[model samples]
Target: MLTDVLKPEKTTRKNAKPIWLMRAGAASELETSVQDWVDASAFKAGAGTVLVVPDRKPGGIAGAVLGLGDGDDPFVSGALASKLPAGDWFFDSPSTADIRLASLGFLMGAYRFARYRKFPEERPSLILDGSLDRSELVALAEAVWLARDLVNTPANDLGPDGIEAAARLVAKDRKMSVRVVKGGELQKKNFPLIHAVGQASQSAPRLIDMRWGRRGAPRLTLVGKGVSFDSGGLDIKPASGMRNMKKDMGGAANILALARLVIDARLDVRLRVLIPAVENAISGSAFRPGDIYRSRKGLTVEIGNTDAEGRLVLADAIALADEEKPDMILDMATLTGAARVALGPDVPPFFTTDDAFADSLSAASLIEHDPVWRLPLWAPYLRGLSSGVADLCNVTTDGFAGSVTAALFLQQFVTGAKSWAHFDIFAWNPVAKPHAPVGGEAHAIRAIFAALRQRYGVTRN
Candidate 1:
């Protein structure tokens, strides 16, 4: 847990070393001896550069300096988490970092998915600022850590049942009520699409629903696509495309993480989370291309392609969420490769008809340092989803506007909500960054949480 690396006591200890954040051409701010030492060590204070000075009398270390180059992102302090020596450290005076963001970044930098590997070395920990909400910070970091851990785990270890088990753990830890409809029960419950996707896998498909907070509070519902493993079903993905199918369930992992954040923060809202867990594997019983199925919302869908399975499971779950017409609907899925091509993996593009909520998310994304771009929910793309055989098709043949069409397909079942937004995310991080490693990542949840907090005042239970 990244939160474990945070010192319980919020004040800086006397024994802890001071870490000064400096930028290029900031030599005048440093003390005379420190400035001379920095110059002697050839430290120009570029971003991610580190220089530690030694104490002459004690023969131990004195303090260290971190270069922030222009320091555009306050969370740039994340880089220092693994760079500095193992010990208690604090950001010192004459530094430019925002204490709260830097502190959060420090925790993020300390994250490691050590479930499979052995990490014998003790990592550095921070004495956090007293003014910051310690509990909130832990909740934020732990939410992201939980998502990363779930996504990083391979399919052999985490299937639909594995996802349900993890949700049970969250329910136990967060004092939430959870119920599941698995196997044939999903079909009886009007979730034929979810069953169709997972019928081929040995692990049964499931619908995991978790609820929390007061009954009359503002209703906020979330739906996530939980394709445990996508061998691309009968259509099949090439070896390169299927290499990282283990992360197909990243949307479920992330939304569950967000649920954890909501419960931990004790937000004043009635929260409901729905995850349609399934594995799109090949077998004699797998749903084949050209198969037509009726969705929970009574809309018929033609299976144009078997690989486009994430949205299939999500459609049924979103329809179920719309049954009661909740205040808002937000569904997340690693649903399209076009999203990656449009905005790349680092910046997930979001679609929403609610302009005000989109603005809120934009502002929150900037403040929280969680990057997300708003893509239009173009109504014109709806025609591409139309089918002569069924009410709609799972995918289009032309392959143009893949992301937009996918979002439009999910929007068909969202008539009852006050507002609805969809996120097409590439959950896997292809390269390492200062705050995160190259693995499964929690993309825009922080920004979304921040927006929700501002929207609904913080009157926690």
Candidate 2:
């Protein structure tokens, strides 16, 4: 989609339509002809609204006016890409908005998941102005598109093996080293929790490990929960709850996208990505709700509910990541519905003990327009996960603080990392927005990337 729309040329086309961006109060200051058109069309410069001006010349469109609302959001420029008629378009004038952000928004807005479509519609093209970094914009858009594509694919086509294949593609593209531990190898390698969760499915559970960058650099480890299709195991979800189960692997998709951005930017950090890919399907071999399993961290976990399998896989992955004592360990998962209940799908809730890290992430979230709200890692909630038969229970019986308890569960596996944070994200967008469509969405990754760039002193140049 990006390749079709974003051009490398800096020069505007002879016949390309001029897209004039306007804010609400500033419409009165426009050129007489444009102002007349705005008045005639009753264009108020409301966000996501577009006004087309017919051409005086004998060809395509003459120009267009895009609403900027109060001129606060730069990403509103994305609306023009989707709303405009099919033709070449260029920014008519410059403003205070970041050119890079606007360009990225345009590319992202133009994205379409046409892999299964028999007839995909043609998208409008934009002539690049050379003010933004084209390479970086393309890379970011492509990474985001990849994440969306992975999440949008159904479980029937994308299971544990499919996830491994996707990881290998990323590793191959970046020249990184990748290793897969699968089947009996997982049990031998002490990933019992991962094995138990995925044992019911014919598609074997596996661990995907990818490493890159210089060994001596500050280690940054990422762990993602990859449950391709969650049937809730023996404790199955109702029909409505199971409808979008294909998107359960959203966390894995997001981490891989972030890794791509980090590698593409060549950040001065040794990157390690661990994904515990599985399917919580019910079968004769399905792990029962009352079963007790030993985790990679040496903690005994009693299965209070098979529906809480995401944390189980993450525990083993986080334990392995902690062994290296990375400078920072960041884990993302679509682990709990309680997070969505508290904050809704648009805002992901994050948990971290480090104050400075939280502050940085919060600031980055604002700057990147990727919303994330901080939730307390309240130590008191540890009591909720206590088990009578084992060291801990996979889920709290009361179901009071589901998101908090899940974070607490994963936190037990990490003692070595200097700093650690967890993101409970709903990867799917329940409804469409101007810049993001309703489908598999990449949450918090941009904010994390921005934070990493600032922390590591990396530049967009």
By TM-score, the best candidate is: 1
In the range 72-157, model 1's lDDT, one tens digit per residue, is: 76666778788888888877764233677878887887888898888857777898766668788888889889999999999989
Clashing pairs in 1: none
lDDT by residue (tens digit), candidate 2, 1-461:
66688765665577677778788876365678888888888888898788988666675466888787875677787787778988788776665345557667777777777778854467678886656666767778888888899999999889999999999999986779999999889999999999999999999999999998887788999888899999999999999999999999999999999999999998888899999999999999999988999999999999999999999999999999999999999999999999999999989999987788889999998877789999988889999999999999999988798999999999999899999999999998898867778899889998988888777654323
**Candidate 2, position 268, lDDT:** 85
> So what's the TM-score on candidate 1?
0.97
Q: What shift in Å separates residue 255 of candidate 2 from its native position after superposition?
A: 0.4
Residue 200 displacement in candidate 1 (angstroms): 0.4
